[model samples]
Target: MANENCEILFDYLRSILYDSTPTQIDVHSLDEDFQKLGMGLQFLDHAINELKQCSTALAKGNLSEFNPSRDNFLCDNLKNIHANLEHLTWQAKQVAKGDYSQHVSYMGDFSNSFNQMTEQLKEREEHLKSEAELEKKHAETVNKYNQLLLELIRQSNDDVLITNIDQSTILYSSHNKVRVEQENEILYYFYKNINNPCEWNMKDKDNRYYHIVTINMEWQDKPSFAHFIHDITQEKKEWDRLHQQAHIDALTQVGNRYYFQDEMQQFLNCKTTATLCYCDLDHLKYVNDNYGHDKGDTYICDFVEILKSNIREDDIIARLGGDEFCILFINGSIDSINQKMEFINEEFSKQVVDYPQSFSYGTIYINGNEDTSLLNILQIADQRMYALKRKRKMTT
Candidate 1:
């Protein structure tokens, strides 16, 4: 009976060590020593079964089932693995929440991989934040510049406007309403030639003049124009006043020598038929020597008034110098000119002055086909006047 019990124990131990299916031992039929051996085999089976359960729990990622204090080697390793895995899981969650400071110390190659992933994530996050800040600053700068530009336009004396190509929509305007009828026409012309800058004069309802300038531009991603209408009413008036002062004689308030030359050149260039009359105050130097320059000036002024009264409005009269004067009559007949000259002489003869207030006069007729220069014509007239003056002096 002892031999049979021994054989059963050996068979069960062999099966437990190397067989796929372990054999069972019957302790009730064995002696006390064999029964003790059977109890030890059962304890080993219980320990292996517990290990299998722990391994299955670990494979399924359940760490609570593993215990290290109960065994050595395999169980202790599993315990350390479970703790490391739990720590790594917590570190992963921290990283996910934007905490790149989390690190693994004891996960071998996985520690290096995790740390590298965190570093890369941190760099990417910082890059994105920097880009976002730059974009925000750019947007703010653009807005500030736009505001300043708007205020400048609003405060300027020059009218500023921004509009689309069709003029259907007005984007911005310095003035609430357009002040001129011609502004719309100018804007239309600007749109037709958008590539070129346009400029023109415009008059407002108050008769004020403005210089309009239109420049092509893009606004809000659409084709548009910026119209600058500068007020030039005062400038125009000032210019006209200056122009008049330049042409007018300061002393006589009539055409000066410069104006006469300019007009004569124009007439000559046009080949206009005209008559030029030259007159010299008979004794201007004598009057100035005896009665002072004031009296001579008065005499000159009186003679000019008489000439202006007797001559037609179309004729140009000019004071060439202190004692010389000239008149240009456009297309005048010689008979009519002679009659006017006689009338002027009679009027001057009636004047009562200490010195002679009379003037010596000569005339030259200019045909449209004449090839004579202005200087030659003036020389002939001057010679005739001097000859007539000499004859008058001798006769007197």
Candidate 2:
């Protein structure tokens, strides 16, 4: 009986070593000495079964399946791993909720990787926040600038127009509704030189002048042009007044000597055909000495009217001094101009009742090929007039 009990005990121990679940021994059938061994093996089997259940649950990722008892120290390490894994899962949930503050420890390489991932996520989150803030600031800046631009456009004296390259459609106009005719005129001028955006001047139907500036620009992300039209009618009038004061004779309303010189120089530069007539009123000194300066002025004005009536619109007449005048005819024959002058002189003599209001004129034809200076031409004309005056004195 003792040998049979020992053999059964040895076989059970061998089965346990082979990782097989040994059959539980009946401790009551064994003798006193063997019974103790039998009970010890039974306890060993229970512990091994507990460990297998815990290990299987862990293998299947079922952490709740096994709870290690205080006496079951064999699964204490697995219990720690399960606790760590549960905490890590909670940390992962927190991270998913945008919390990168959670950290792990004692998890070897996984801990390092988790910490690195959180750190990188935090950096990325901060970067995104910074970009969002920059975008917000940029948006605010753009809005402010847009408001300022709108206010400036509203306050501007110039009529601001934004349009597509097409002439008829106006995308935006700073001013209120414009008259149809005026709008058409503006668009006509605007599109006339759309291909060449530049500053120019145009006159409206009402004879109002405008200084226009066109610039290529974008409106609502579409290619467009901005037209700034400034009403320069009043300015133009003032400029004309100033020009008249500067370049016109106050008495005769003709061009002054300065104006004549400037026009002659410009005409010379053109190198084109023209005729110059230098004239002197026949008895200006005698009229001033006998009938006072007023009649002399009247005499000068009367001769000026004759010259003006005979000349074309583009022809220039300049009062050089008291009674000497210069008349320029662009592209005319010297003989024809001289005849025109002689007729004017004869007409003036016939009209004069109070005094001799006639004039003597010397004309020179310019073919534009000559490189003669204006002073030289005037000197020759002056000498010819004096010679003609001397001959008239001898004949009369």
Candidate 3:
């Protein structure tokens, strides 16, 4: 359309110029007065009309007639327009081949309307490239974290599992079927009802015990979770071993220091009005002198066994140390205390079974005068034990 319009204007211009043209249409320096110029009044009127139409087009930002041709669309700097089209064509080819880096850039000095448009496309390309790089880095980081998580899963001893707070499955240990199912059941139902320290104990179908500890971790915050369990079989075995150890004397297996002290405290609490019988094997040192310390030790242990067998299960008998021993009478009444004393005397008189070992008896009554604080009471009982020793010496 613009080319046709140009042709039409040029044709009209030729008609007027040929009949009465401005061989030199300089407005000033015309070589002739305005009335003498070619086309005279008729040419002046056409020139004025053409100038007004062009001016109107310029003011409306449409200085040329509308034509769809690419060449006519070049409003300014034809070189810049050419470069822009080449860049756009290259970008299109790259897009077709799946590359996105080609972008339009005109010569810096060629500031034109095309420059603004290409600069905008350049900015958009840079933004997209940056966004793609960020996404790539994020994916790499997530892959690394997942790799580390996979390694950790391999090394764990307890059956580890993860789940949503809503009881949806996330992950679990591979080899442990019975435990995972049991633990999953427990965590599914119990965690919400209890305080958040959500803990439970389970025995798997394998009869293996596990102490499960559940902890909630924040992620997408839709109650994603993790769990750990500890197998307690070895711990249970140690406990049983310790429990057996706790009740027996290391040397004699009668009662350990702990058991003896516990029994003493309980006996004292309940049997207040009781007699404490303190005894020592009579000639233990003489035996150590004649035979070796080994034989003397053997004699003492044998003596303790005899005392234990002779006493009631309710009776707490202990080897105080070396050759000395102690016993408590739950029956603290005078008759009962005396009867226990008589029995010990009778056993002393009768014993010599194989290797002779007899103990001297010392009886102390619970009464108004003795300082009965545990240690003091034992001290008082020992003192009375020595006085009984003196009487034995006289009899011997």
The residue pairs found clashing in candidate 2 are none
Q: Candidate 3 — number of clashing residue pairs? A: 1
lDDT of 3 by residue, 65-122 (tens): 3222333222334334444555666666765564544444444554344445556666
Tens-digit lDDT track of model 2 for 1-396: 889999989887777656656666678888888989988887777777788888888788787786766687777888888788778888999998899999988799999999999999999999999999998998889889978987887777767777786555888887743455776788886666444578888888899988878898877768888877788999999999998899999999999988998999999999998999999988899999999999989999988898888889999999998989999988578888888888888888899368877787788887789798998899989988988899999998
- Residue by residue across 159-180, what tens digits does model 1's lDDT show? 7778876663568667733454
What TM-score does structure 3 among the candidates reach?
0.43
Cα deviation at 164, candidate 3, in Å, is 10
Flag regions of model 3 displaced more than 4 Å.
1-154, 159-228, 235-250, 262-276, 328-338, 354-356, 361-373
lDDT of 1 at 190: 54
Every model's TM-score: 0.54, 0.63, 0.43
- Candidate ranking under TM-score, highest first, comes to 2, 1, 3
Candidate 2 residues lying further than 4 Å off, grouped into runs, are 1-135, 165-168, 176-181, 394-396
lDDT (0 to 1) per candidate: 0.80, 0.84, 0.61
As for lDDT, the candidate ahead, 2 or 3, is 2
Error of 1 at 362 (Å): 2.5
Error of 1 at 353 (Å): 3.1
Cα miss at 52, model 3 (Å)? 54
For model 1 the TM-score comes to: 0.54
